[model samples]
Target: MTRIASYCIAASALFLLAPSAALAQEGEATPPPAPEGQAAAAAAPAAAPAQAAPAKAEPKEDLKDKPAPNSIYAEGLGAGLWYSINYERRVIDDLGVRVGFSYISIGATVSAGNSSSSASASLLTFPITASYLGVRSGKHALEVGGGVSVTYATAQASNSFGSSASGSGVGAYGSAMVGYRLHPVDGAGFNFRVGAMALIGPGFNVFGDDPTAFGVLPFGYISLGASF
Candidate 1:
């Protein structure tokens, strides 16, 4: 009877503990609830890295192969036939226009048989021309052009007897030129040229001398200046 009672008590105790062990194992397998701060952080999206601002673009420089536009030069034996100071402008690519001025004065004395006569004269010349630059290679060029030159003259004469006389006149000559030039190709610099000119005009007496012969006269010239 004692052995049977002990065996029955052991079986009852094991049956009562089995359900509690299973419930404890199930509770350990499930995760605990997160704290409030940790839950909010986990639920939100991650932050992105910061990016720098873009740099500004710079302006580009200009580089062109064209020559300068303005020039001032002195010329000898050109349209003025003596010397002249000239200003020139490039009206377009390979084309130029020029204007110049010159002045001259003369005095003479004649004596015969205790009588003397004095004479004086002055001349002003203006030249205007347009030229075309043809064949060209770095700083060297060929030029051809045509235009007209206008001249004004004044004369005065006096004798020992106090008699005086004065007169003035105007004249024009048609002129043309062909030449070679040494000029700057890009910017402001030295300029030089040599050329031949042909002049045609009517005959007249402007100075108190013989009348000028009418014809085409071939002349030569040289020039020097700065181009800008």
Candidate 2:
């Protein structure tokens, strides 16, 4: 009976110690809880760098093609009956004024009964005009304008007998023109023009008795020059 009681006491003490050892081992195996802020930072991904916006581009200016503002040219059968040298200047973008000059002279000598006579005659023409240029397309444009012409004539005669005579006259006429023009758009270069013109004036008789009569005449001209 004594041996059986001692065995029971030892078995009970082992059962209590076994349960406490098992609880300590379980506690050591599990980790402690982390702080809330630290846990959130670890779980979330890093933010990407902020991106900059692209810059806007500005528009460029247009380079328009245009003719030069001044020109000098020789014209045939327009302002002058034969030819004239003309200079033109643009007061505005598309408006221009021109002035030109032309001249002609005649001379003759006559011998009659020992009394010789010599005579000379001269004509001077001045043309002044204002014109407008049309819209340019490439290197070409349409030109139109009108103006006036002034003519001065003089005659002188002297005989071997010492008799002398002289006369002079001034006349004015109206004129107009329409034509195509080719010129340099950017700089100095060759320029050309072709057009028709009309002149209204009094017809003058160089040899006949009647010196002035009303008349209208149609003419044409071709011009070549340099533009700047």
Candidate 3:
């Protein structure tokens, strides 16, 4: 019975010591499970990428100026043999007024059936008009207009038979015109106009009782002038 007790005690001690020796010889330990809080933090979804800010825009500038409406101009003019001086004033962008004076003189002698007659005629006309600008380009312009005129005229005649007569009168006139104006230097620069005009006046004599010399006259002009 004593031998059996001693053997049992030695067996229990060997079993405990054997486990400790095996652990020491292995030289490694099993890791514990991760904490719940640390695991949740690691598994959270990554933050989304940040968005960029938009850029600001810049403003634009104006390039040019609008002109004032009023302007004035004058020019030398001619149509056929008559020479004239022309004047114009624009009261608004598309509207204007003009005035001009034109003059012509001629002398002639006629002979037949043993008789001779010498005659001379002198004429003066003033044309007044209201115009519209139909075209407006940078430095070029076109216009059309119509108005009335006044004419003062005279004539003299003397035949070889010592017979002579003279006449003089003032008459009403009407006219229409189209003109193209050019500004060579700039918007308000040295300017000129090319135009066609027609004058119609009824028969009224100043020098004699016969009809006046200028009944229906058509003329052209190249005029030089300036404007402001």
Candidate 4:
């Protein structure tokens, strides 16, 4: 009976030891599953940095191939009972050519003690000019040019001294002008300018030159005009 008890104790001990040995082997052999929270945290930090990289690279495309504003102009001028037709074409941003035709006339009459005199003068002038124009901003501009003018003038006088005089002349002149331009509206608008010009050169008489010889003369012009 004692031997039978000893054998039974040994079998119980073997069974207990077997379970401990198996548990130790399993602990050393198998790996644990990764922690879900830790893995997700690591992945989120990496993804954030990757997403932020694209935003820094996006602005380079926006700065490429940008365009500029349009800079071009066309203008004209006219004035008074003495009228002028002028055209300006811009060759560059601030330089241009001015071309124009002008017409002028004047008449006078006097009487003293039944003696009467009448006088009249008419002129047609054409100017071809090149100009340098400057506009620092919108609505204001300055212009200067030197030009050649061809003028055809006719004068007639009838006096009480029993003399009637008529004269016609053709003149070649050079002139310079400076002016300001004001624009009040948008592109489809008007511009007004005021300026003074000096004309000086020689003339030839076609008829009636005995009393007044045609030669170099100084003439001046004052003008106000608008452009549309």
Q: How many collisions between residues are there in candidate 2?
A: 0
Question: Lowest-lDDT window of 10 residues in candidate 4?
Answer: 63-72
For candidate 2, lDDT tens digit of each residue in 1-228?
Answer: 899999999999999899899989988998677899999999999999999989888876433465678999999889877788899987876788989998989999999898899999998999998878866686788889889989999999999989999999998888889999887777788989899988877773333455576566778888999999
Worst 10 residues of 1 by lDDT: 202-211
**Model 2 — TM-score against the truth?**
0.65
Model 3, span 1-228: residue lDDT tens? 999999999999999999898887665665565799888888897789999888777765322222223344444443322556666666665577777777879999999999999999998978677878647765566867778877788999999999999999987767677888664323455667788877656542333455665466665666666665
Order the candidate numbers by TM-score, best to worst. Answer: 1, 2, 3, 4
Q: Give stretches of model 1 more than 4 Å off.
A: 1-64, 204-213
* C-alpha RMSD of each candidate structure in angstroms: 8.4, 9.4, 13.4, 10.6
Per residue, candidate 1 scores C-alpha lDDT tens digits across 93-186 of 6889999999999999999988899999999999999988857776688989989888999999999888999999998888889999877877
User: Candidate order by lDDT, highest to lowest?
Assistant: 1, 2, 3, 4
lDDT agreement with native, every candidate = 0.86, 0.85, 0.68, 0.59
lDDT of 4 at 9: 100
Instruction: Identify the leading candidate in terms of TM-score.
Output: 1
- Quote the positional error of residue 192 for candidate 2 in Å: 1.2
TM-score to true structure, per model: 0.68, 0.65, 0.53, 0.45
Q: How much is 186 displaced in model 3, in angstroms?
A: 5.6
